[model samples]
Target: MKTGIIGAMHEEILLLKKDIQRLKTEQFGSREFHSGTIDGKEVVMALSGWGKVAAASTATTLINHYQVDQLVFIGLAGSIQAQLHIGDIVVANQLIQHDVDLSRLEHFPEVKSPFWKDFSFKVLPQSEDKALQAVETFLANLKKGDYPAISKEYAPQVHLGAIGTGDQFIASKDGKMRINERFPQILCTEMEGAAIAQVGADYQIPCTVIRVISDKADEQAHDAFAEFLFENISNISVEIAKLIL
Candidate 1:
């Protein structure tokens, strides 16, 4: 099966690009698409840029142009749940767009919104199962000696839950509270996961999102995300991909 891998930022996919063998690169809508095999598994990789529109566009292009069978997204997120801290992994079983509330416009009578009923998109059950198992295998055999020194500080724990996506980077406690109040089940927040998941649903393609916690979604979130991005976090994606691919 051919898999299309997307990352929210260049750093999120940097190591992945290097791992692809016999890579063929091309430009689509000004974004580079790398087609190759990762450990003999057919794959295509691309940076999905930063927000809903960019991610959805990239996802649609990957589905229509590359004709990839399954999609896997790897990125960083801000933790909404107090128990979740930096380096923790979240495998999204479902995704929703927190920024898409249209209930206020219900009085328009002609306004149709998916959020009015149910906005969450479930990851394909079969693909979600495979991803969860892969994460388990990755975690079970992980050794500090096998990774960077920074990894020694915390052993990453996997959490399977719903993730909220929006164009805004949640940097305040009040913003976090408002989201949690509406989507009480959201484990983390990011800029692109749900948009890509929606595209997958539209195209009938299986999609899986894996996020590593980089911030607490609080006042200091910006600094946290920046620091975590420069660390050895990308290695986590590489190890998980090996098991999944």
Candidate 2:
């Protein structure tokens, strides 16, 4: 089966693009898709850009055009939880849009969305149990000898929980705290995961996101991003994909 891989930033998918064999490029609406095979699994890789619109648009194309059986996204996120540190992995069990306020629209859908845009029409998106299990399997056998970062006694942890997405970047302690209050289960915040999850849901495709924490989402967020934005955290996503495939 073909799998579509998307990353919000160039660095997120660069290594995977380099690893693809028999690559072919195709463009639609200015977005380019790199289609090929990753260790024998048919794959399509693309930069979905930042925010909800870009991610949703890219996801629609991948599902409709490539006929992919599943979708996977990997990108960087800022930590909302104090316990989370740089280089930690967050495997999304569910995704919601922290910025979408639909309290007023409750009568519209008559159902409920952890985010906006749904109730009667749609609901939040989630990774399949098997998807989480596959990722956990990969993590279980991981060795610190190869991944020196995790080799340390206080190595970063691989957490699985809800991920919150919004178009706006969270860079203040207050903003981070507010979201934490709203979505008490949120592990990380980023720009695109929820949108992709929604699109996958609309098309009945399974979706999964693997995020690496690169910042604290605090006043120092700007500095933290500048320091680690291009450090290729997307490698974690690719490794997870390789194991699952």
Candidate 3:
């Protein structure tokens, strides 16, 4: 079975690409896709860019051109829940496009943007199981000193919950409050997961979304974001990929 692994940035997928044996690279939709075996598992990896449209297009291309049977997306997200701090991992059980609003339409006043039934996608059970297992394994390795500690006092915790997706990068306190009020169960906010999930749903390909908390969705969200990406997120992603693959 071929698995299509997607990340929204180069740092997220760089180490996984290096792990691929007998790698082959190709370009499609202005994105580079690398195909090879990781731990005897056939996989295709790519950067899906940074928004719903880009993610959907890349996912569609992977499903259509590469014939990937399943999809996995890993990236950094701004935490919406106060309990979730940076370095914590969130395995998305469901995802919603929080920015979608059809509630204003005269005929569709009953359709509530994020609350609408069609606006959400549930992760496939089997795929979620695999992802959870991989995360648990990674955490175990961390405890065994195979990976670096998340912090002096904090061991990264895994949370399974709803993740909100949208085009906007939530950076202000008001933005976080609005989304939290709208979707209280949402653990984190990011740009791409739900869109790819929608495409996966369309093609009947199972999808799994795993995100690492990079910043709190607040006024200071962008501060040190780039440093966090390079210093921490990439290595965590590599460990997860190793277990998942």
Candidate 4:
């Protein structure tokens, strides 16, 4: 069972590539893909680049070229929920492109587009049952311990809920508030999860999205993200990868 693990940034993909024993590399679409074994499981990992289109294209390539049986996206996201804070982890149960509004986008005439032909602004579904079960097991079976990058006071929590995606980074207060009102159950917001989910839906590929909270989706998000860009972000992601994959 070959798994395709994707990340949007170098930090997100580097450790996994390093962890792969007897790794081999191949370049595709200007991105390098590393293939090897992870915890005795055959896997291919790559940096999918940023945004919805890049993620979708990467997913398609992994499916077609690597023929990966399952897909996993591990990265950081901005927390939009009131209770969530830094170092918190979120296993996406659902994903939606909050920026997608077929009604509003379809009305544009000058710069014509066809991608929104029959699409709707609804929750993009993902095949995540087994992945969700694995996460539940991980949380339930955990022993008392402190996470390295996580603060003891915050006592990092695990959230399972919807993840919103869009090209624009959620920073301004109004941007964060609007998304919150649109998707009340959102656990976090990111740039690529929904697009990856959409490609999975097309190929019937099972997908699991895991995001660590890096900042609150507000005016200070960009600054906070810079201050808190944990160097070991890939560590938590790989830990979850081992358990789920």
Best by TM-score: 1
Report the lDDT tens digits of candidate 2 across residue range 6-68: 988876776678888999999999899999997888999889888999999999999999999
Give the local distance difference test score of model 3: 0.88
Each prediction's Cα lDDT score?
Answer: 0.88, 0.79, 0.88, 0.78
Candidate 4 ranges with C-alpha deviation above 4 Å = 104-129, 133-154
List TM-score per model, in order.
Answer: 0.94, 0.85, 0.93, 0.84
lDDT of model 3 at position 82: 93
Residue 49, model 4: lDDT of 83
Candidate 1 C-alpha lDDT tens digits along 98-154: 988867776897866654355689988898898999888877767536555346665
Runs in model 2 deviating more than 4 A are 107-144, 147-154, 232-234
- Residue 83, candidate 4: Cα error in Å is 1.6
Clash list (residue pairs), candidate 3: none
Model 2: ten consecutive residues of lowest lDDT: 118-127
